[model samples]
Target: MSLSGKLETDVELKASAQQFHEVLCSRPHHISNVSPSKIQGVQLHQGEWGKEGSVIICNYIHDGKAKVSKEQVEKIDPVNNSVTYKVIEGDLLNEYKSFKITVQVTPKGTGSVSHWTYEYEKLHPGISHPETLLQFAAELSKEIDSHLTSAK
Candidate 1:
Protein backbone atom coordinates (compact mmCIF):
# COMPACT_ATOMS: atom_id res chain seq x y z
CA MET A 1 0.00 0.00 0.00
CA SER A 2 1.09 3.57 -0.70
CA LEU A 3 2.04 4.92 2.71
CA SER A 4 1.02 8.32 4.01
CA GLY A 5 -0.59 9.83 7.09
CA LYS A 6 -1.43 13.16 8.71
CA LEU A 7 -2.19 13.99 12.30
CA GLU A 8 -3.22 17.34 13.71
CA THR A 9 -3.41 18.69 17.23
CA ASP A 10 -4.53 22.00 18.69
CA VAL A 11 -2.26 23.60 21.28
CA GLU A 12 -1.70 26.97 22.86
CA LEU A 13 -0.02 29.33 20.49
CA LYS A 14 1.55 31.38 23.32
CA ALA A 15 4.99 30.28 22.30
CA SER A 16 5.78 31.35 18.79
CA ALA A 17 5.28 28.62 16.25
CA GLN A 18 8.96 28.93 15.47
CA GLN A 19 9.76 28.05 19.05
CA PHE A 20 7.75 24.84 18.92
CA HIS A 21 9.22 24.07 15.53
CA GLU A 22 12.73 24.45 16.92
CA VAL A 23 12.00 22.14 19.80
CA LEU A 24 10.56 19.44 17.59
CA CYS A 25 13.17 19.69 14.86
CA SER A 26 16.27 20.23 16.97
CA ARG A 27 15.77 19.61 20.66
CA PRO A 28 13.59 16.55 20.52
CA HIS A 29 15.96 14.78 22.86
CA HIS A 30 15.35 17.54 25.39
CA ILE A 31 11.83 16.26 25.74
CA SER A 32 11.97 13.46 28.24
CA ASN A 33 8.35 12.54 28.88
CA VAL A 34 7.29 12.39 25.27
CA SER A 35 9.97 9.97 24.15
CA PRO A 36 8.80 6.45 23.53
CA SER A 37 10.17 3.48 25.44
CA LYS A 38 11.78 2.34 22.21
CA ILE A 39 13.81 5.51 21.90
CA GLN A 40 17.00 5.46 23.99
CA GLY A 41 18.52 8.78 22.88
CA VAL A 42 18.94 11.31 20.13
CA GLN A 43 22.11 13.15 19.07
CA LEU A 44 22.95 15.88 16.65
CA HIS A 45 25.31 14.49 14.10
CA GLN A 46 26.23 17.40 11.80
CA GLY A 47 25.41 21.02 11.05
CA GLU A 48 23.53 23.44 13.26
CA TRP A 49 20.24 22.67 14.92
CA GLY A 50 17.02 23.82 13.22
CA LYS A 51 18.84 24.37 9.97
CA GLU A 52 18.68 22.71 6.62
CA GLY A 53 21.28 19.96 6.13
CA SER A 54 21.57 19.28 9.84
CA VAL A 55 21.59 15.62 10.79
CA ILE A 56 20.40 13.73 13.84
CA ILE A 57 20.89 10.18 14.96
CA CYS A 58 18.10 8.45 16.88
CA ASN A 59 18.92 5.42 18.94
CA TYR A 60 15.93 3.22 19.47
CA ILE A 61 14.79 -0.26 20.39
CA HIS A 62 13.07 -2.29 17.72
CA ASP A 63 11.77 -5.80 18.23
CA GLY A 64 13.59 -5.77 21.56
CA LYS A 65 16.84 -4.86 19.82
CA ALA A 66 18.73 -1.59 19.70
CA LYS A 67 18.83 0.23 16.40
CA VAL A 68 20.05 3.58 15.13
CA SER A 69 18.65 5.78 12.40
CA LYS A 70 20.08 8.84 10.71
CA GLU A 71 17.95 11.69 9.46
CA GLN A 72 18.79 15.02 7.83
CA VAL A 73 16.90 18.27 7.87
CA GLU A 74 15.63 18.87 4.39
CA LYS A 75 13.85 22.16 4.89
CA ILE A 76 13.00 24.80 7.48
CA ASP A 77 10.55 27.66 7.18
CA PRO A 78 10.16 29.72 10.29
CA VAL A 79 7.74 32.06 8.63
CA ASN A 80 5.48 29.15 7.83
CA ASN A 81 6.19 27.38 11.07
CA SER A 82 7.26 24.25 9.28
CA VAL A 83 10.21 21.87 9.16
CA THR A 84 10.86 18.77 7.08
CA TYR A 85 13.30 16.01 7.80
CA LYS A 86 14.34 13.18 5.50
CA VAL A 87 15.60 9.80 6.55
CA ILE A 88 19.15 9.27 5.30
CA GLU A 89 19.98 5.84 6.68
CA GLY A 90 18.82 3.33 9.27
CA ASP A 91 16.65 0.30 9.84
CA LEU A 92 13.78 2.11 8.12
CA LEU A 93 15.86 1.91 4.96
CA ASN A 94 15.04 -1.75 4.81
CA GLU A 95 11.32 -1.15 4.58
CA TYR A 96 10.88 2.14 2.78
CA LYS A 97 12.54 3.61 -0.25
CA SER A 98 12.43 7.07 1.34
CA PHE A 99 10.77 8.86 4.22
CA LYS A 100 10.01 12.51 4.82
CA ILE A 101 8.25 13.89 7.83
CA THR A 102 6.94 17.43 8.08
CA VAL A 103 5.65 19.35 11.03
CA GLN A 104 3.62 22.47 10.46
CA VAL A 105 1.85 24.88 12.78
CA THR A 106 -0.93 27.29 11.99
CA PRO A 107 -2.93 29.59 14.17
CA LYS A 108 -6.45 28.48 15.06
CA GLY A 109 -8.40 30.93 17.17
CA THR A 110 -6.57 31.22 20.50
CA GLY A 111 -4.58 28.08 19.86
CA SER A 112 -2.52 26.65 17.02
CA VAL A 113 -2.89 23.49 15.02
CA SER A 114 0.15 21.31 14.78
CA HIS A 115 0.09 19.20 11.67
CA TRP A 116 2.34 16.17 11.33
CA THR A 117 2.68 14.51 7.97
CA TYR A 118 4.56 11.41 6.97
CA GLU A 119 5.28 10.62 3.35
CA TYR A 120 6.88 7.35 2.45
CA GLU A 121 7.15 4.67 -0.20
CA LYS A 122 7.07 1.10 1.05
CA LEU A 123 9.57 -1.35 -0.38
CA HIS A 124 6.86 -3.95 -0.66
CA PRO A 125 3.08 -4.02 -0.87
CA GLY A 126 2.94 -6.00 2.35
CA ILE A 127 4.24 -3.11 4.43
CA SER A 128 1.43 -1.47 6.33
CA HIS A 129 0.78 2.23 6.70
CA PRO A 130 2.32 3.77 9.83
CA GLU A 131 -0.62 4.24 12.16
CA THR A 132 1.63 3.95 15.21
CA LEU A 133 3.76 6.78 13.91
CA LEU A 134 0.71 9.02 13.84
CA GLN A 135 -0.15 7.96 17.36
CA PHE A 136 3.35 8.85 18.42
CA ALA A 137 2.92 12.31 16.95
CA ALA A 138 -0.35 12.70 18.81
CA GLU A 139 1.32 11.70 22.06
CA LEU A 140 4.08 14.19 21.48
CA SER A 141 1.52 16.91 20.91
CA LYS A 142 -0.25 16.02 24.11
CA GLU A 143 3.05 16.11 26.00
CA ILE A 144 3.84 19.54 24.66
CA ASP A 145 0.40 20.77 25.56
CA SER A 146 0.61 19.33 29.04
CA HIS A 147 4.03 20.82 29.60
CA LEU A 148 2.81 24.23 28.58
CA THR A 149 -0.30 23.91 30.66
CA SER A 150 1.71 23.01 33.75
CA ALA A 151 4.22 25.79 33.22
CA LYS A 152 1.55 28.42 33.24
Candidate 2:
Protein backbone atom coordinates (compact mmCIF):
# COMPACT_ATOMS: atom_id res chain seq x y z
CA MET A 1 0.00 0.00 0.00
CA SER A 2 1.10 3.57 -0.59
CA LEU A 3 2.46 5.52 2.34
CA SER A 4 0.31 8.47 1.40
CA GLY A 5 -3.25 8.01 0.17
CA LYS A 6 -6.73 9.37 0.21
CA LEU A 7 -10.01 7.75 1.21
CA GLU A 8 -13.35 9.08 0.05
CA THR A 9 -16.95 8.18 0.69
CA ASP A 10 -20.34 9.74 0.03
CA VAL A 11 -23.25 9.02 2.32
CA GLU A 12 -26.84 10.04 1.77
CA LEU A 13 -28.41 11.71 4.75
CA LYS A 14 -31.85 12.98 5.63
CA ALA A 15 -30.67 16.29 7.03
CA SER A 16 -30.40 19.51 5.11
CA ALA A 17 -26.95 20.05 3.62
CA GLN A 18 -26.79 23.69 4.56
CA GLN A 19 -27.66 22.92 8.16
CA PHE A 20 -24.98 20.28 8.32
CA HIS A 21 -22.45 22.72 6.92
CA GLU A 22 -23.40 25.30 9.51
CA VAL A 23 -22.95 22.79 12.31
CA LEU A 24 -19.47 21.93 11.10
CA CYS A 25 -18.28 25.39 10.16
CA SER A 26 -19.94 27.63 12.71
CA ARG A 27 -21.59 25.77 15.54
CA PRO A 28 -19.37 22.76 16.05
CA HIS A 29 -19.27 23.33 19.78
CA HIS A 30 -22.98 22.76 19.86
CA ILE A 31 -22.56 19.22 18.62
CA SER A 32 -21.74 18.02 22.11
CA ASN A 33 -25.23 18.93 23.18
CA VAL A 34 -26.66 17.30 20.10
CA SER A 35 -24.77 14.02 20.49
CA PRO A 36 -23.16 13.92 23.87
CA SER A 37 -22.24 10.26 23.60
CA LYS A 38 -20.32 10.59 20.37
CA ILE A 39 -18.98 14.12 20.63
CA GLN A 40 -17.69 15.47 23.91
CA GLY A 41 -16.73 18.97 22.98
CA VAL A 42 -15.31 21.29 20.34
CA GLN A 43 -13.28 24.23 21.59
CA LEU A 44 -11.51 26.93 19.64
CA HIS A 45 -7.89 26.92 20.59
CA GLN A 46 -6.76 29.86 18.49
CA GLY A 47 -7.95 32.36 15.95
CA GLU A 48 -11.68 32.81 15.45
CA TRP A 49 -14.56 30.51 14.69
CA GLY A 50 -15.64 29.81 11.09
CA LYS A 51 -12.42 31.11 9.55
CA GLU A 52 -9.48 29.60 7.80
CA GLY A 53 -6.41 29.16 10.04
CA SER A 54 -8.52 28.82 13.16
CA VAL A 55 -7.52 25.81 15.26
CA ILE A 56 -10.14 23.74 17.01
CA ILE A 57 -9.67 20.96 19.50
CA CYS A 58 -12.21 18.17 19.23
CA ASN A 59 -12.92 15.62 21.92
CA TYR A 60 -14.89 12.52 21.06
CA ILE A 61 -15.42 8.87 21.80
CA HIS A 62 -14.23 6.48 19.12
CA ASP A 63 -14.09 2.72 19.28
CA GLY A 64 -15.39 3.02 22.83
CA LYS A 65 -12.37 5.08 23.85
CA ALA A 66 -11.92 8.79 24.25
CA LYS A 67 -9.80 10.61 21.68
CA VAL A 68 -8.77 14.12 20.88
CA SER A 69 -7.92 15.91 17.66
CA LYS A 70 -6.44 19.35 17.25
CA GLU A 71 -6.85 20.59 13.74
CA GLN A 72 -6.68 23.84 11.84
CA VAL A 73 -9.28 24.94 9.37
CA GLU A 74 -7.42 24.84 6.10
CA LYS A 75 -10.32 25.96 3.99
CA ILE A 76 -14.02 26.69 4.13
CA ASP A 77 -16.10 27.00 0.97
CA PRO A 78 -19.67 28.02 1.57
CA VAL A 79 -20.42 27.86 -2.11
CA ASN A 80 -19.28 24.25 -2.22
CA ASN A 81 -20.53 23.54 1.28
CA SER A 82 -17.16 22.11 2.23
CA VAL A 83 -14.78 22.41 5.15
CA THR A 84 -11.24 21.05 5.23
CA TYR A 85 -9.39 20.28 8.44
CA LYS A 86 -5.70 19.45 8.70
CA VAL A 87 -4.86 17.61 11.88
CA ILE A 88 -1.83 19.07 13.61
CA GLU A 89 -1.88 17.40 17.01
CA GLY A 90 -3.42 14.67 19.15
CA ASP A 91 -3.83 10.90 19.01
CA LEU A 92 -3.90 10.63 15.21
CA LEU A 93 -0.33 11.91 14.89
CA ASN A 94 0.93 8.81 16.62
CA GLU A 95 0.52 6.80 13.42
CA TYR A 96 0.42 9.39 10.68
CA LYS A 97 2.99 11.93 9.69
CA SER A 98 0.24 14.20 8.40
CA PHE A 99 -3.54 13.92 8.19
CA LYS A 100 -6.30 15.90 6.59
CA ILE A 101 -10.04 15.43 6.45
CA THR A 102 -12.45 17.23 4.13
CA VAL A 103 -16.21 17.12 4.57
CA GLN A 104 -18.60 18.37 1.90
CA VAL A 105 -22.37 18.30 1.91
CA THR A 106 -24.55 18.80 -1.12
CA PRO A 107 -28.26 18.85 -1.70
CA LYS A 108 -29.81 15.62 -2.90
CA GLY A 109 -33.38 16.30 -3.77
CA THR A 110 -35.27 16.63 -0.48
CA GLY A 111 -32.29 15.56 1.59
CA SER A 112 -28.49 15.75 1.25
CA VAL A 113 -25.38 13.67 0.84
CA SER A 114 -22.17 14.12 2.74
CA HIS A 115 -18.78 13.50 1.14
CA TRP A 116 -15.93 12.67 3.45
CA THR A 117 -12.32 12.43 2.36
CA TYR A 118 -9.27 11.50 4.34
CA GLU A 119 -5.73 12.27 3.21
CA TYR A 120 -2.84 10.95 5.17
CA GLU A 121 0.79 9.87 5.16
CA LYS A 122 1.68 6.88 7.28
CA LEU A 123 4.43 7.11 9.87
CA HIS A 124 5.62 3.59 9.16
CA PRO A 125 4.82 0.56 7.05
CA GLY A 126 3.51 -1.31 10.05
CA ILE A 127 0.80 1.24 10.65
CA SER A 128 -2.64 0.09 9.63
CA HIS A 129 -4.92 1.86 7.19
CA PRO A 130 -7.65 4.23 8.36
CA GLU A 131 -10.73 2.31 7.26
CA THR A 132 -12.04 2.26 10.80
CA LEU A 133 -11.60 5.99 11.13
CA LEU A 134 -13.44 6.54 7.88
CA GLN A 135 -16.24 4.37 9.16
CA PHE A 136 -16.21 6.40 12.33
CA ALA A 137 -16.59 9.56 10.27
CA ALA A 138 -19.50 8.04 8.41
CA GLU A 139 -21.14 7.08 11.69
CA LEU A 140 -20.61 10.57 13.02
CA SER A 141 -22.31 11.94 9.92
CA LYS A 142 -25.31 9.75 10.62
CA GLU A 143 -25.44 10.96 14.20
CA ILE A 144 -25.36 14.55 13.06
CA ASP A 145 -28.07 13.88 10.54
CA SER A 146 -30.26 12.35 13.22
CA HIS A 147 -29.60 15.27 15.52
CA LEU A 148 -30.62 17.74 12.83
CA THR A 149 -33.80 15.83 12.11
CA SER A 150 -34.83 15.66 15.76
CA ALA A 151 -34.02 19.33 16.36
CA LYS A 152 -36.95 20.18 14.14
TM-scores for every predicted model: 0.80, 0.96
lDDT of each: 0.73, 0.93
Question: Ten residues in a row with the worst lDDT in model 1?
Answer: 1-10
Query: lDDT tens string, model 2, 1-152?
Result: 67998999998889889999999998899989877888899999999899999999999898889999999999999998999999999999999999999999999998999999999999988998899889988888898899898878
Tens digits of per-residue lDDT for model 1, 49-144: 777899998886655677777999899888888888899999877887888888898766656777888888888888776666666566667666
**Cα lDDT for residue 46, model 1?**
92
RMSD from true fold, candidate 1: 3.2
**Strongest candidate by TM-score:** 2
After superposition, the stretches of candidate 2 with alpha carbons farther than 4 Å from their true spots are: none
